[model samples]
Target chain A: MHIPFDQLKAEFKRVLLKLNFTHERADFCAQIFAENSRDGVYTHGLNRFPAFVQHIKNGLINIDAQPTLINNLGAIEQWDGNLAPGILNASFCMDRAITLAEQNGIGCVAIKNTNHWMHGGTYGWQAADAGFIGICITNSIANMVPWGGSTNALGNNPLIIALPRADGHVVLDMAISQYSKGKVLQYQSFEDELPFVGGYDGDGNLTKDPNAIIESKRLLPIGLWKGSALSMVLDMLVSALSLGKTVKQITDQGNESSASQVFIAIKPFNA
Target chain B: MHIPFDQLKAEFKRVLLKLNFTHERADFCAQIFAENSRDGVYTHGLNRFPAFVQHIKNGLINIDAQPTLINNLGAIEQWDGNLAPGILNASFCMDRAITLAEQNGIGCVAIKNTNHWMHGGTYGWQAADAGFIGICITNSIANMVPWGGSTNALGNNPLIIALPRADGHVVLDMAISQYSKGKVLQYQSFEDELPFVGGYDGDGNLTKDPNAIIESKRLLPIGLWKGSALSMVLDMLVSALSLGKTVKQITDQGNESSASQVFIAIKPFNA
Candidate 1:
């Protein structure tokens, strides 16, 4: 249960290479996955690896594909992820953004056809480590009901804002959902009821029971209507900026592939 | 009680002139105060005007002062607000940022020694209407306790993000607090319990009583510890970017003047 970090990364790299990933792609992605676990983000680390591998096997992720730029408008660039692994594609895009910012003070990259990047904080940390202020967002499959609505129709899309500091890079990464589905699953795994009402029950009453919430699939968005509006706005921004599929379109695809994401890097003036 | 907008603005204008404000300054400040109320932010508009006037009278806000540029590095500029009214200083800074973005792809302006911007969304809408993505944030007097700390040591600092949209111009203006102090006062006026647990009682148990919360000054930050961390990180970013006062320093001020803020504008690719 507590494998060494290096072993975990090596295993991921082995699997990815066996699946035909290029040497560079397997090494970079496997390192990120291992780092997520070592840094205590279990949901996106070891636990997520199985689901990630499954997605690739199911053709939701294309191991050999990479992000390719499609449009360039001043400091903004649009790219197609080519259904690539989200972690690799995200890193590639942020690198591009950083390069552009180094030349133009600020840069933005929007990509479509991305898979889940796992923990969003990784990208923020990457940018901060590069001496840039970074903001990143991604639109996911709808697992949350819009506020004031009883149906599931919104994504608990995460937002990350990081500022480079001499001390630990200040990073704020949060999902619009009060409790993400992974968090609920974690609580259920521990056989613990959530301390607060995480979502609604099948009968439509707020409930703390993690199992009931997972069963009902009525995850509560953060701050009710506030988070719903935020989710919609973030979705619109990522989709519009990337000129890619919206959440509605992503869900209609019947699989959570080809999602859209946006990454921005602002070169710190002082840096 | 429904005052004509012009009459309300003119009355404010009259007071600022009496206080020796320049003609342009008085009119600019008065117009924003009136527009805030018209846009349904009465808490920061008419209701707060008396206190704002009192601050000037008490010499808390420096009526004759204006922001002076401290540094300009690439597209980022830093200003010292010279203890001016937050609304005036913030508008000017955002305007400067817009000018920078017009030249470059993005621009940032961070200000120190400012007072509170009555409505953060006002500046956000300003940038969105200019067809750019806008973001702004401000640190406040400490009013919320940090996570795991019973005493207040964090500002319920507001963060605003707006994207120019074809419809509605998606703007999110939110404080880290679950319910802002002004909102609690509104609930108290109606003799109503907060619909949710807005803060902890004297004994640190969650409660809905607006009176108790206001008395305690122990407002709950949104998402419990999540917002607390966010507010802290935001304060750090503002302080670092402007090389200005931190929340700790602002709290040490006898009253809530001389706060710091940051504004950023990024040109959309399409434009």
Candidate 2:
């Protein structure tokens, strides 16, 4: 059965309000979730909503918490997310970055202690809609093996870049892995092999068998060593800029929380 | 056959000076070429020196041109490279970015009309040596096929990111292509199949045979569609920022010259 967009959003807002979200916050987040589905990112849209609510129930996300400024260095700023809802914090940070970029030509905001931002493209689109170039990245718990290593030692960090145009904005949102863990599980549920090599098996040989990769927990990074290095560098950049938890630190806690993120906005030449 | 670094640099300087370069310019360019070899990037080092000289001889590169500021907007600046040497222009831009970042915590410099910057890692190392995080990218003539397309439609743009540390810096220099055109040619010459799928053959099937890919001119982008989108976006970014030539325009000229590039530097939290 197909659900109407407004109805989906209204339902989400109702649930969030029941969970103590302010009306404005609830409406904004609900719209984003609805838009994610509208934009065809179902994995991060309705499919992830139940888990998101559970996280709030478990205190992994604090509904009323807001980001607090830590430091400001001209075009660069840092903040503590204070365990706030990732969507709200991400939106606020990008808004701040756009404001700073309006004055400085370019601005960067790094935040620590933020939860998952659901769909990173939301922020990219946010900046693009404001007529600016946007770039954002976030680190997650380790879920992929580094090149030439046997165990999982790297996070499939996601990167987003958006360019504004009169016709249509160009946005790219990608993780460093060839296939995300979710995608692998999806393929495994259907008992289908991946179209390309996705990871290594227990024998340390490359394979396209999703089940083998899942069982081994050895997801392959995109472009082999190149993506591995990129992932590590991105993790370092976010953690260093925010003075927040690293991927290793988050992984060591045995749960994903308090992740670091960076958002940058650049005023276009025409803008 | 072993040559000392100083001797090689001296030889290069002699040749450049004979071609009417100023003493200082000749010395600097010679040192970078020698350093490329010292760093084991033989393709951009001694192996590419003859072509470099030929480009100068052919008037494709100007020995006396320098970058001139076009616009300055606080933390971001745009410059015209005036067809200057890529190494010199890239270094100068990065230096300017570093200075701006020092004053503003983050800075970006974009330039158009630059020539080929051999071994982009040189600039990454330069930034890290000065205790800053550096990120840079340059657009090139179309050399790889975009995902799902049957012809060459994208540049194998290189991206470089560097992070500073107390003991050793981390630097990642990568081209978006799974294997560079030069690497494919090398494998063909060696009569060896690629260790992984490198590109598509004339029949549009993925293959590890370097010869087929070289003949078909269908070098694959890293991570398939992901890198293809990334390469396109990087091109758009550099061109839009500098108001310079796009990959299509550069390829239309049937030669690689007057490329666009961007350099960014950020002050780390500790710094």
Candidate 3:
């Protein structure tokens, strides 16, 4: 059950290379997936590798596609991800954001047409390692219900904030939902009820039963209306900034691809 | 009980002018307080006017002081609020942030020594009205307990996000607590238990009794550990960016006058 980090990474790289990824892309992605597992995020790491490869085989991820420049403002720029691998697009955007911050004290890069980035905290840690403040957000397919709504009309968007410190970086990565779908699935697999109310039951009342929540597809927001409104605004912020598809559009497209995201970096005066 | 908006603003202006506020400053502060009431936030409006004036009379808020530029880095700037009225300083900073964003597509302004800015959503609305995405955060005196800590060692720091829309703007202004101290006080005064568990009792168990929470002073964060970590990182961010005092320093100082805050504005690509 325990594999050496390098061995896991090498296996992932080998698979990716066979899937038509370039040597550099495979290595970068393998390292990210390996680190995600090392950090205990198995949901996005080894467990998710098969689905990731399936997306590639389905042509949902255009490995050969590159992000194209859209608009270049002094401190803010917009890009079109061109359906590229989320890991590569996100890495490139964060790099550009950091570079712009170096030149202008703060920088913002928004991209459209990106795929799922797997773990957003990767970019946050990236900026923190570079000695800058990082803030990023991404809108996903609808997996949550808006506050007071019975139907799923919101995405469990994740927000990341990171700051570099002398000892270690402080990073806060959070999702708008109280429980992620992965968490709900885990609870269901164990035939266990949630410790607290996770979502609504068939009667439209709060319930701890994961099966009911999963069937209803009404995952609760973290702070009720507070998280609901936060999710909506974050969606607007990312989608509008990138001039990309909103949650509604992405949901209508029937896949979680071509998402909008924003990456921001701020150069600390002295850190 | 149902004062007209202009009448309420005029009354606030009358009292502020009597406290030696300049005409412009008095008008601005009064309008903000009045709007707070108009928007149904009476806690920071007519009901909180006496405390606002008391801060001025106690020499905690220097009505004559103005925000001074500490450092400028093109798209980002640092400012010293000079113990000025929070409403004025916050407005000035947001205005500068918007102006800078207009020039560079994104801008960030961080300030120290600022007082309470009434409602954080005020600045969010200000930026949204100026056709920009606004994000702001401010550190306050410790009022909530940090995760795994029983003491009130974290500020219920508020985060604000706003986006411009063809319809009404979407704004989210939320503190890190499940229920703010002010809300708990309101519930206590009304002799009502919270609808949900608000905080811990003396025995360190979650309780809905407002009186018990008030006595224990262990207000719960919104998402438990999530909000605690968020409050800490936000504190670090505002303080580090502005070179201002942190929650620890503010709590030790025994007053909330000299607080740190950050305002960010980004030009949206399109509505």
Specify the highest-DockQ model's number: 2
Model 2 lDDT tens row, A1-271: 8999999999999999999999999999999999998888877889779989998999999999989999998999999999998999999999999998999999999999999998999999999999999999999999888988988889998999999988999999888899877778778878999998999899999999998998988888888888898899999999999999999999998878899999999998777
Report the C-alpha displacement of residue A194, candidate 3, in angstroms: 4.1
RMSD of each: 1.9, 1.6, 1.8
How do the residues A1-271 of candidate 3 rate in per-residue lDDT, one tens digit apiece?
6899999999999999999899999999999999988998776788778888998999989988999999987999999999999989999999999999998999999999999888889999999999999999999999788877878789988889999988989888888777777678778989999987888887789889999998987888877776788788899889999999999999998888999999999999775
Model 2 steric clash pairs: none
Q: List the TM values for chain B, per candidate.
A: 0.97, 0.96, 0.96
**Candidate 3 global TM-score:** 0.96
Ranking by TM-score: 2, 3, 1
For candidate 1, what is the lDDT? 0.86
- Supply the DockQ value of model 1: 0.42
What C-alpha lDDT values do all the predictions have?
Answer: 0.86, 0.92, 0.90
Q: After superposition, how far is residue A103 of candidate 2 from its true place, in Å?
A: 0.6
Q: Which residue pairs in candidate 1 have backbone atoms (N, alpha carbon, C) closer than 3 angstroms, thus clashing?
A: none
Native contacts present in each candidate (fraction) = 0.26, 0.74, 0.74
Select the stronger candidate by lDDT from 1 and 3: 3
Best by TM-score: 2
Worst 10 residues of 3 chain A by lDDT: A177-186
